[model samples]
Target: MIALLRGFLWLTGFWLAGESLVVLLDLPISAGVVGMLLLTIALLLRIGRLEDIAAASQPLIGLLAMLIMPGVVGVFFVADEFAGQWLAVAVALVGGTLASVLTTLLLMRRCMPAAPRTETPQETSS
Candidate 1:
C-alpha cells in the first residue's frame, strides 16, 4: 500500500511537471505524451526505479486497458465524420500502427544485447 501510494505520487509529480513545462513553453503537444516521455527518460536514467513503482504500475497499466473503451465509444459518436473520411482515417490508422510497431521494434532491438550464436551441427560437420 505504501509502495502504491509512492508510485502514484511519483507519477503525479512527473505528469504535473510535464504539464507545467508544456504550459510554460506553449507547446502544441499533449501533456500526457510529455509526461510519458518524461517517465521514460527518468526510468532510463534510473531516477525512477521499476521495483519502487511496480505495484502501482501494474494496476495503472491494467486500468489503461479499460480506458480504451471510451476511445471506442468516442469513435462511435463520431461515426458520421469518420465515414466521410473513411479512406483517410484507414490510411492514417494503418500508417500510424506500422510506424509505432517499427519504432518499438527498433528501440527494443537497440536496447537489448544480441544473444550469443551457437554453431549448428552442419557447421560443426563442415
Candidate 2:
C-alpha cells in the first residue's frame, strides 16, 4: 500500500509538471503525454531509477485493462458512427502505423552508433 502511494505521488508529480509545461509553453500536447515524455527523458538521463517507479506502479499495472474498459465501451457504443468513416479510419490507422515505424527507425539510427564496416577480399580484384 505504501508502494502504491509512492508510485501515485511520483506519477502525479510528473503529470503536474507536464500540465505546467503545457500551460506555460502553450503546447498542443496533453499533460499526460508531456509528463510521460519528461519521465522518459529523465530515465534516459539516469536522473531517476525504474525501481522507484515500478515499486509503486506494479500494483496498478494489472488493472490497466480494467481502467481502459470505459474507453473501449465508449468506442463500442459509437461503432455505427465509426462505420461511416471506415476509409478515413483505415487511412488514419495505416498512416499512424507507418509514421510510428519510421519514427522508431529514425530514433534508433540516431541513438545507436553504426557498426564497423568489413570489406570482403572478393572485391579487391576490381
Find the candidate with the highest TM-score and give its number.
1
Q: lDDT values of the candidates? A: 0.84, 0.83
TM-score of each: 0.63, 0.58
Across 47-102, the per-residue lDDT of candidate 1 in tens digits comes to: 97677677777898999878788777776687776577888889899999999999
Candidate 1 lDDT at 81 equals: 62
- Please write out the lDDT profile of model 2 over residues 1-126, one tens digit for every residue: 666676678888899999999999999999999998988888788875577777766767788899988888787677787778988998999999999999999999999877545645556787
lDDT of 2 at 106: 96
The lDDT leader among the candidates is 1
| Candidate 2 clash pair list | none
Give candidate 1's whole-model lDDT: 0.84
What lDDT score goes with residue 20 in model 2?
A: 100
Candidate 1 lDDT trough over 10 residues, lowest sum: 115-124
Residue 123, candidate 2: how far off, in angstroms? 36
